[model samples]
Target: MIEIKNLSHSFYVGKKGKEREIPVLNGISLEISQGEIASIFGKSGSGKSTLLNLISGFMKPGSGRILINGEDVTSFSEKQWAAFRLQNFGFIFQNFQLIPSLSTFDNVALPLVLEGVHASQRKLRVQEILQRVGLLEQANHFPNELSGGQQQRVSIARALILNPQIILADEPTGSLDSETEKEILNLIRELNRQQGITFFIITHDEEVAEISDKRFYLHDGALVNGGVSIEV
Candidate 1:
């Protein structure tokens, strides 16, 4: 579960010496329930990615509170945040973000190995997730050998390998062809339905929004429907 309060973030723009401050998020706030899929839609510079970064602790908000499972992430120390991210969060990026040198299986197993899972157990779990993402046969292949969709599937497997409570995906389907996009969407939707893995994905795609339990719009750094959306 996620709870955000009065969240705001900004960055500098213009020439370095004469830069101006531009706000990316302005008092945005919302809550995402366990097992829910939420999509954020916005224009090119509308701060959708910034909001995801804030939630993931990659970028700290200037002012606000972010709570995960009732733990206020704003209060986390550097090490604490690292631990929490490791144990509770999974990420899928538009680029797939795979390590160029690592084989698919190794990349998928990285998270579990980082958690100190035993080698045998990690191998089994990695294989299981790769199978889930339909990448079992590609296990020994390097990222460069895979197509865009396959690489993204491996990224999904890497994210799921840890079994994190929440998945944060930024344009997971952005780089694929329409048919491949459909495949990825169906995969993610089924994962959400069958495994109850909550997802908060930032996407410009309407089809992605349609699959979500609900949608939110971001513009000028504000969360649309935040105040008026009923609890039910």
Candidate 2:
């Protein structure tokens, strides 16, 4: 389980010489189980991304503790977070974040390369993930050559390649058309059901929220209506 307790964060923004602390998340607490699919809905600047960053260990919270499976990770160092992320978390974003210069296969294999996996092993893993995402035929194609849905598929493949326990998605369907968005949602659901991977998705769309087992709304720096039931 992932447990967040009284988490609060703020940013200093203003003139270079004078800045004030602008609160983002204020006394937020939540929990996600091992294989649950949860969605947090928020408007722009609602601290949705900030929450994800803190949970993923990309940023430290100003207060409170983040516990994953009974381990406190709030105070982890950068090096520790790096190793931890590689072992436990995967990330997906609206922009896809694929390398334009590299082929789909190479893009998905980048994480394994960082882990010092051998070339042969990386190839096998990348191939398996690509096939799982239904993108094996496009492995040699560059990002620019694929459709938007296909590109997102590559991004999903890359995320799953590491076999992480949790997948953090920020507005995952923000750039897709309705049909493509449905396809992506179905893919996410299938993966979660089959692989038992947990998903913590942040979005503004009701469609995305409908697919979640638990739903949350972030308002005024606090999470409201968390774990509420929504008609799927």
Candidate 3:
């Protein structure tokens, strides 16, 4: 569950000696229910990723309140944010951000390792999630040996290995072919349906938006619907 109230963000642009605030989000307010699949569509530089970063604690909001499951996290310290993210959120990226050198098993085990999980337990958990993502047989393979879809599956397994309550995916299907994208999207939907994991996906793909339970578009740092059809 997520609750955002009157959220706003901006960045300083221009020369170092002379900068001005360039607002990205203005008075954003929205709530995402548990287990719901939600998509936010927007053009380039429309602040879609900004909102995700704000929610995930990658960057603090300039001004506003962000509550996860009823706890306000607006002022959380860096240490607190790190702990909270590890315990509550999983992240998937467009590029499938896996280490080129790490084997699939090791890649998926990174989170557990960071948490100081024992070797045996980490192996078991990694195996389980790899199997769930249909990557069990490729456990020992390196990123370079796998296809794009397979690589993305590895990323998905890594994210799901911790069983976090929410998954924040940015452009999840961006790099895959259309057919592969369909498979990945289906996998995401299946995971949401079977595991009840909430998905907050920011994507420019209409096909991705179609699979979501709720869809909204971002325009000039604000959310809008019913008038201009969201191309993204």
Candidate 4:
């Protein structure tokens, strides 16, 4: 459902007149099929996150093309990207990225609210997703009131609230304990199995990579090990 071709990106550092180019991704090409859980493993500065950002439309690649669900999104304008992302993508971050002031329900409902859904419909959708993530009881809680795992569940609920076709997770379990990590991973697997959602995860943990249908190793801004599917 996702494809990257000849993707490369660089950043410039130093003063205005005299700057140096630091390459982050180089000729990266990969494809992820619908309903598959794929992961990219890399150490710091390996460009794994950069690849995700480019695909996310948060940053543009210096040279390359990105296609999602047969639509070429490489040159999508900001407005177009916003609309497309709302319909097709959900994002999870290492930090959970939840607004501390919002209740779990509101946090999960934010996307629907942005899309202009009515209150009654948003209420049902948010409650359903929160229940699926096992956070219905915590709906009234604030971020600071919940445990790390619970907070991450809130993040997952928010992501799933939109019924996105693909979820881009970055170090999804980074803030949790080992047991909690396992729980989150299992939840991810369950969601994929039941809903046929494609998952593209960026993480450094071997345990996280273990759950993936396909694994890729990134090093020095390139794929050191081809993104090959593993026999399940």
Candidate with best lDDT: 4
In TM-score terms, candidate 1 sits at 0.94
Residue 115, model 2, lDDT: 91
TM-score of each: 0.94, 0.95, 0.95, 0.97
lDDT (Cα, tens digit) per residue for candidate 4, span 43-75: 987888899999999898999899999899999
Candidates sorted by TM-score, best first: 4, 3, 2, 1
The true-versus-predicted C-alpha distance at residue 100 of model 2, in Å, is 0.6
Report the lDDT of model 3 for residue 208. Answer: 91
Model 4: CA > 4 A from native: 226-232
Preferred candidate (TM-score higher): 3 or 4: 4
Task: Please provide the root mean square deviation of candidate 3 (C-alpha atoms, Å).
Answer: 2.5
What lDDT, from 0 to 1, does candidate 2 have? 0.91
lDDT of 1 by residue, 24-56 (tens): 899988888999998887787888999998899
Residue-level lDDT for 110 in candidate 4:
96
lDDT per residue as tens, model 3, 1-232 = 8988889999998999899989999888888889999888888788999999999998999999999999999999999999999999999999999999999999999999999999999988998899899999999999999999999999999889889999999999999999999999999999999999999999888889998887778888888853233322
Lowest lDDT sum, 10 consecutive residues, model 4, at 223-232
Candidate 2 lDDT over 105-157, as tens digits, reads 99999999999999999999999999899999999999999999999999999
Q: Residue 8 error for model 2, in Å? A: 0.9
Best by TM-score: 4
After superposing candidate 3 on the true structure, give the runs of residues whose Cα lies further than 4 Å from its correct spot: 15-17, 225-232
